[model samples]
Target chain A: MSAERLLWYTAVMAGVTYLIRVLPLVLFRREIKSPFVKSFLYYIPYAVLGAMTIPAVFSATRSLVSACVGLAVAVIMAWHRKGLLPVAIAACAAVFVTEWLMRML
Target chain B: MNAAERRQAFKTGFFDGLPIGLGYISVSFTFGMMAVEKGMPAWAAILISFTNLTSAGQFAGLDVIAASGSMIEMALVQLVINLRYALMSLSWSQRLGPEFNLIKRMIIAYADTDEVFAVSSARAVGGKRLRFIYMVGLMIMPVIGWTGGTVIGALASAILPDAVRSALGLAIYGMFIAIIVPPARDHRSVAVVVLSAVAASCLFHFAPVLKRLSTGFVIIICGIGASALGAWLFPVPEPDCKPPDLEERSAHEC
Candidate 1:
């Protein structure tokens, strides 16, 4: 793509993104009426997180295995309500160790 | 919320964003590396990371750059990948003080990353004001980490060993886990998480129809469809509380 085209594309996407993000705030104001919409909205984060993570973690790729281990440990830590830092550290350690172990095995 | 309490919301939002910043170092590093690999300038990669504060959009944008797509294509890609932020921003604005004018709205909108949105949303439900302090509350460390990562990624592409770089790449996926699994314990949310992912994977892998579609198009279809369906399936009960605001009326109530 031409430089001009790329910049234009970026600008337009930025606008759409900003608009989409800001519009509901502008339009809805305080009225998120449908309990269904509210409930569904709650799940968007999970849905995005899950769909994004799983494929990365379990696919037939090396990093994926480490990612799974790190994630599993992180979940356990968070479920127990550990601080975010420890969970993140332990999970990252899990990935590093898993990768190292795979190399040894 | 009083002065002290409003201050506490900033603390909550800030710390909530803290741990995740660690994971960003590696991911943004790779993103910067990849962006440069695709001929995006070092400064451009860093700028994108700093401004967008998103993983999915940057990744898709990188692909768009790789494809040498038209400017329209690039923007559409960003729009599709980032559509979720709209929902997040909407949920947050309601929690803002009525005094919040255009400027405050603009600041919060710029800082609305996934972690910020998540933490701010939680506090907002309690009807506490976090968005005002919310930008300063959550964004400083992350902005530093992301920008730093990109700088290193761009400069270190040749020096970093492939195996080590590849290993570190796993950190991004790990970060996603930190973001996802803890929240999935709730059943209604869990089902949404599982199905949406399964659907994204299946649609991408099996649906020859989608193969021709751009990354931007695919994400929009998946995100909108999954979110809409999940909403249809399990709705949250409306809170039965007096006055949506969470600040105690009496000075002693807090």
Candidate 2:
């Protein structure tokens, strides 16, 4: 892509995303009014989060090993409910190290 | 509410996000490395980190670059993928500081993320000032980690191992586990998460119609579809908030 084009796309993305983030504040100050809208909004995040997180975990290989390893580590951490920092470190380290060994063998 | 309160939110928001910063670094570091591998300059990669603060968008954008997508394609992908931020921001707008000026609101808007959303949502029902604080806690560390990771990855792309790179590819998958699995043990987010993922993947792999879709298109379609369904079925409130019964929630809900 051309430099101008890339910059334009970046700017547009930033602009659109910003607008999306900001426009609501501009329009809905007190609270969203409509019940259906409210009901729909309720599921939107869950749906989005579900959509975003799911494909990442279980596509292509069907091996839950990688996902499971990361989950087990995270659950242990979040359950004992240690700090997210420690949990992240432990989890990322475990996954990376495990992948490393797997690759080696 | 007051200057003192705003200051408090700032401090808490900044500190609260510290741990998330570490995770952002590892994953985003890999992103920067991949950008370099794909021929993006280090500055470009770092700039992307500073600006986008999104994992999926960046990864998809890189693919767009690889495919030599048109300008329209690039813009549309970003628009599609980042559309949720608009809703997130809108939801947040209701809760964040009422006194917030347009500029402040605009500047801080893109700072919303999953973690930021979590923290900000916690305080949203109470007041704008508190929401702002929660947002602050959520972002301070991520910005540092993300920007710093880009620079490091861009610099060390050549040195990073394939094993590590592959591991990073699984970061999203790992996160799903963290989000979905525990909930499954009970009867929780497991169904929605599992269904959405399986549905999308199956579509991507088997559904002939879905095969023609770009990465951005795939994400948008799957996200919008699954979220729409979950929304209809589950109907989480606009706020979707917990009623501050922390003790009860902690014991049973998660």
Top-scoring candidate (lDDT): 1
Candidate 1 local Cα displacement, residue B205, angstroms: 4.9
The candidate that achieves the highest DockQ relative to the unseen native structure: 1
Candidate 2 residue lDDT tens string, B1-20: 48776676666667556655
True contacts kept of each: 0.43, 0.36
lDDT of 1 at B140: 69
Question: What TM-score is obtained by chain A of candidate 1?
Answer: 0.72
Judge candidate 1 at residue B159 and give its lDDT.
Answer: 65
Worst 10 residues of 2 chain A by lDDT: A54-63
